[model samples]
Target: MTGGRTGWARVPAPVRDAGLVAVAVGDAWLAVSDSSWPEAGLAALACAALALRRYVPLVVVLLTVPATVVADLVVAPLAALFALAERRHDRRLLGACAVLMAAASAAPWPWHDPDSRDRTWTLIQFAYTLAGTAAPVLFGQLVQARRDLSRRLAEIEEAREHERALHAQAVLARERAQLAREMHDVVSHQVSLIAVQAGALQVGAKDTDAREAARTIRSLSVATLDELRNMVTLLRASGGRATELTPQPTLADIRKLVATSGIDAELTGVLPDTVSTPAQRAIYRTVQEALTNVRKHAPGAGATVELWCEGDDVGVTVTNGRPTRPSLPLPGSRQGLVGLRERAEILHGTFSCGPTPDGGYGVSVRIPAQPA
Candidate 1:
């Protein structure tokens, strides 16, 4: 039954209207008698008026009344009444139309003269017609109610799906915040202790080799602490509002970052202050990650950090010379460059990292001076 209704609904509106008009005309044809010109004209008017039932249902029902009064026309008036009932919500108006249709169907023609018995039969027929008229009106109202129910159910389902999505996002945000707290409280504390211990060992060590080892450990621990703090800030923010948990790096920090990188790196060039905070942060991070990689993967390598700008474009480049000594085998997650690339893409910029022509590595990122 549902499939049948769906198929019927798929029929074009004009086609359905044409089909109803055809059915109404056929009903008029079957009922009209003796080629009576006036009756036939009235019937035709009622049937043709069915074509406009969707646009003016009340007017169509009124137009069908003349044919019902003059001839035994059923389909035209009933179809119009049904259309009126489906679109209108006023029960009083529908009831009035039903009464009018019944009266029109029951009345004797003007040419007819009725006796007592004929009058009695006419009254009985009137009651029967009145009762029958209720069918189309009631059926149309039912169809209207069903359509409303279907629409309401769809709205409710959409709201429920939206609520479920919001609940899932809220749960995920809470989890990220909890993870950030754990890293800050536990992992950060441990790394801070390691850095402090390494610094103390470096200060008191008597042998040259032990002092150098302590210094290296202290520098790595401090760098790890810096990265961990940044990670915690990001997790706690959860891609929401800006956070003050850690001071975000800007262009001013680039020189300090290079100086403490534990690499013989040179910093040159300048960018205008018109550069956006996010763009500056991207520049700072690109230089930081490039230098860190140099220390980890290219021991004894000297690096050059250059800041430059062009028309509507500003960027940073970090290039390192070939390693003069063998690098230590240190475990790496290899996500730093990937993270830099993602950041660049977010800023509508470009990032590239590869070995240079001089047997060295170079990392470059270019971003807009003022992104929207």
Candidate 2:
């Protein structure tokens, strides 16, 4: 295991040096077994220099040169050459070291008497020398290549896992959004039914207490409805929170909304029966939110809702006089106005809301009757 900056590169220096020392000592034993004790000492010293092969490759190679020239001691120098190739992929330096080691392996042959320097012996010696030098360099390069490939593969696998995690998160978000929308639809429908029943009870009750109780139920229902609508708006604005498939309220449903609001509200002007469903829904929601605000902020203050078509555009204006009696304002996020403005802008229309000169609150929205 060896590479540019990983694999064997991560091995501690001490451990690496110890491993090289072991290899050098084994080589010395093999070389010195048949040689003189002094030659054995020199071979062992040359091999020991390999302990610092990675730290001082050139120096170790030089130290091993004299031993190799005299006794054919090669293991330590071969190890040094391998370390050099792993550290620096310099072809010229590698070629020079290879040639020097090969020449040392061949030097012993020329010194043999002329009778022993036969052509067959010369070829065998040359081939053996080249294999010894070339084997370490080529083997080191092969190991480095495999280590580098393994690292790249690991990196690619890590990137792929990251992308998969992101994709899973996105899918989960979409599912959550769908759940939110479903919950809003189910809760809102039930709450509206409660409000409608309470309104009917208020209208029919003969006793004062019964009527008051019905009014309280109606008021609470309307407040809950407003809160629900705000929740839906927030979810819609947020990404990957929910999806909705429930039937949306249109201009026809405006009557029921105003009727059950428990506020004095007047609906005026003509609402086109043939308007697009989106425009009708927008108009219906605007009036419903405005009526809710009137009940919460301007209790007992009569409000007016005007719906009209102007050429290519349809419009709705909800205006209410200031509160006639002191009223405890209902808790709200005040996102209704923001939602209305966004609705208008999305249809390339205009929306405005503020206090009028007469101290009344007014909200006006104009959207395309038919989307362009």
Q: What is the C-alpha lDDT of each candidate?
A: 0.82, 0.74
Give the poorly placed runs of model 2, Cα more than 4 Å off. 1-39, 45-142, 163-247, 250-255, 264-284, 302-316, 340-351, 364-372
Task: List ranges where model 1 is wrong by over 4 Å.
Answer: 1-7, 111-122, 207-209, 239-372
Per-residue lDDT for 140-235 in model 1, tens only?
999999888877888898999999999788877766765564455445545555665576578789999999999899889878977886787788
Q: Indicate the TM-score of model 1.
A: 0.58
Q: Candidate 1: give the clashing pairs.
A: none
User: Candidate 2, after superposition: displacement of residue 113 in Å?
Assistant: 17
Tell me each candidate's RMSD, in Å, in order.
13.9, 7.6
Q: What does candidate 2's lDDT look like per residue over 179-222, in tens digits?
A: 44443434654565567568768878999999999999989987
Worst 10 residues of 1 by lDDT: 239-248
